[model samples]
Target: MSASNNTADREAKLQRNPHGDFNAVEKSRPEFEEDVEFHYTRTKDIEWVPGSGATSDDWKKHKKIAVDPYAEGRDPLNNYKLLIAGIVPRPIGFVSTESKAGIRNLAPFSYTTFVHHDPPIFCIGFASSVAAAKDTLANIMETGELTINIISEWFVEAANYTATNAPPEISEWDVSGLTPLASEKVKPPHVGESAFSVEAKLVTHHEWISKVTGKANGTLVIVEGVNFHIREDATNESFTTLDPKILKPISRLGGITYGRTTQAFEMLRPSWADEEKREEVKKILEK
Candidate 1:
C-alpha cells in the first residue's frame, strides 16, 4: 500500500477506537466490566468529617444530626420552628364553631380538605393539642354543626392569625378583628370577610393515633355541607363561571411557600368527528 493510504487507514482506525491501549480502555469503562470489584462508600464518608467535635456521648450532643425528643438542653421551640418553617404553604381551612355558652369561635387548620362530594363531605384534621380543638371538636360533637369559611388570598393573613394559640374563652374572630356573619343552616357563624363559606353538620368524629407519641392526638371531623354562601356577583349560571382572578384562592405548598391559582387551562376529549380521525390514523399506523 502507498504510504499516504497507510497513514489514512491508521487515522481511521484511531478515530474508530480513541483509546489506543486496551488497559486504558478497561480503566475508562469500569462500569461495563462485570468482573471488577465495586467498593461502595457511605455518604457520611464523603459529606461528614469524624473527629472529637463530631462524636457526642449524650443524645443532646447529636441534636445536629438526628431529632432526639428526650434530648436535654435542647429548646422545644427549635423543633416547632423547624416544623412550621419547613411545612411551608400549608392549605388553610378556616373552621367556625359555636360554644355551649353561645360564644362563637373561628379557627384555621392546615390539615383540611374535601374527601367526598357525593354526600358533600369535607374534613378538618384538628390538633387536640390546641385548646381550640377541644372546644371546636367538642362543640361539633355536641351540637353536630360547624361552618368552613373558604379563604382567598385577600383573607389568608387574617386566616393565619386565627391559627394562633388562643384560649378557649377568647374568640378568634375578636382576636383577629374579623367580622362574623350568621349562617343560614348551621350554628357556627362564617367569617364575613371570606368570599365563600359552607354551613355543614358534623357526620363523624374519627380520632387518630400519633405516630411519634403513640397517643390519640387529633380528631378528623367529617362534615356534610348543608348550604353554601357564595359572593353575590361571583357565581354564574354555569359552574365554570367563577373567575379565578377574582377568587385568588391560596393553596398550601412545601415549606413556607404558598400557591395561588392564577392561571387556568382546559383540555377537550375526542368528539364523534375526532373519533373518526383517530380511526383513520390507527389504520395508517397498522399498515
Candidate 2:
C-alpha cells in the first residue's frame, strides 16, 4: 500500500475507536447510579461583593505557562484537544438531515452554539469542507435544511450512539432507535425524543483554509431557526424560558466526558441606574 493509504487506514482506525480498550475502561469506572435529581439553590458566594475576585485564593499561588499552538513538535490534534478541554460544557447539536435520495442522517456535533436571538441564528462547525463533508454536513449542503435536537439525560445514551462512524448506507436513526417526528418547514424530521428542537435552514457557509497547508480544513455553517418545538412540561405558559429541571440538558466536556445540568444558581444582572448598586460598584472601582 502507498503511504497515503496507510495514513488513511490509521486515521480510520483511530476514528472508529478513539479509546483503545472499551470494556476494560468501563470496568474500571464506578457502577452507574440513578436518582440524581436537579437541585436549584443560591450562588456559591451569595454575599460576595464586587472586586473580591475569585471565591478561593488558591488560584493566585499557581503560575501559568503560555502554549504556542503552532510549536514545532505540536500536531493539530494537540490544539484540538487543548481547546476542547479548556472550553468546558459545550452544548451538543444533535443534527438530523436527509439526502436528495431520502437517505436520513443523524449525528452529534460539539462545535455548535446559538449566536443570535432576534432572527434565531445558530453556528455549526464541521471539520471538513462541502466537497469532503461528512454525512450531516453533506446533507445540509445538498438540501439546505436540518433539525437540531437538544440532547437530554433521558435519551443521552441513544443520542450518543448516533455518533457511531457508520457507513453512508446506514441510517443513525435505526442504529440509535430514535423516533423521527415530522417537521413543518424542513424535510428532515426531528428526533421525537428531543424535548427541545429547532427546524433550521442554511443561511450561509464559509470554508476555512489552513494557514500552514492552504487547504480547506473546516466549514462554518450559519443557520436560521425557522421553528421551535418545546415540550409543554419543559416550558411555562409565557414560553420565555425553559426549566432546567424538566429539560435536563446534557453538555459535552473534554475528551470522552459529558456533563449534566442537575444543579444551578441564578445571579441577577446589576444595573448602574440603581443608585445602591452604582454606589457599590463605585466603591469597588475607587478602591
Candidate 3:
C-alpha cells in the first residue's frame, strides 16, 4: 500500500475521540493555563566558576546504557521515539504551500530549524521519501515556494489541526480555520495569526536512503527566506529581536506534548579581554 493509503487506513480504524468524549477528557485534566507570563530569572543563584559542572547533585547518581541502533532486536521506531524525546523543545514550522494545481496545504513540521542567517536558510525534514512526498513536501517540490509561520500560543490548536491527515483535495487552511495573508514573493499564503513568518523559496533538497532496507527513507529540504514578516508590536525598531512575551511561540516535545516559551534567562558571552573573565578562567585552570 502507498504511504498515504496506509495513513488513511490507520486513521480509519481510530475513533474521533479514542479516550472518552472530548469534553470529559478535558475536564479530567486541569484547565489550560493561559495566564502564563514571560519573565527573566537567573540560571543559577550561586557564584560560578568555569569548570563548575552541572549544578544539580543528582546527575552523577545515574548511569547511562548504550544500545546499537542497528541491533538485531532493535526496531527503527524505537530510534524515532528516542530522538524525539531526547531533543526537547523543537520549534514548529507551520508551513503553507500551494500545489501546482492550486490546492493549498498547511501543516506543522517539528523537524524544522533555522540553520543560517547570511542567506537566511531554514531546514525542514520530511519523513517520507521524495517518491512518496506528502502534501506539504509535494507542494513545496512542485511549486518551489512556501511560507513558514511561527505558531504562537494563541493559535496553536488551530495550527496543530492542520497536521490532520486529510486528503489532498481538502484544504488544511479551511480545516484549521486560520486566516491567510497574501505573500509578497511566494504564491502560497502565510497564516495571518503568526506573529512572525517567513516567505521562503526552495533552494535544494536531499533524500536519505535507508542503510538496512536500501530504500528511500526521508528528505531534507533547504529553503531561503526571501522575505520576513514580523508583527510591529512584537519587534523593536530595527526588527532584530522579537519579544518572547508577545510571540509566545509554541514548541513540540515527545509524544503529544507541547511546550511554551513563557520564561527565559539571558547569559552574556564572556570576553577574554575583560580582567574578571580572565581571572575566573585562570582560577579554574589552576585548580
TM-score for each candidate, following the candidate numbering: 0.61, 0.92, 0.92
- lDDT by residue (1-287, candidate 1, tens digit) is 43334435544543433356856766776353224332333432233322224444576655455778546766433554466556765657788999778877777767787888888899888656322245677678878888887788767777778766566687888878888898988778888887778899988788877556576656788889998877766677665355555566777764334676655445345475565556455665577
Judging by TM-score against the true structure, name the best candidate.
Answer: 3
- lDDT of predicted model 1: 0.68
CA RMSD (A), model 1: 26.6
lDDT of each: 0.68, 0.87, 0.88
Clashing pairs in 1: 88-255, 88-256, 89-252, 89-253
lDDT of 2 by residue, 1-287 (tens): 43334436646643534567978887999876567778878987988876668899898899999999888877776677778879999999999999999999999999999999989999999877677777899899999999999999889999999987687789999989999999999999999999999999999999999766688878999999999999999999998889888898999988778998888777889765774566568886677
Local error of candidate 2 at residue 8 (angstroms): 5.6
Model 2 lDDT on a 0 to 1 scale: 0.87
Model 2 TM-score (2 dp): 0.92
Winning candidate number (lDDT): 3
Pick by TM-score: 1 or 3, better one:
3
lDDT score for residue 13 of model 1: 43
Runs of candidate 3 exceeding 4 Å displacement: 8-25, 275-277
Rate residue 135 of model 1 by lDDT: 61
- In terms of lDDT, the poorest run of 10 residues in model 1 is 43-52
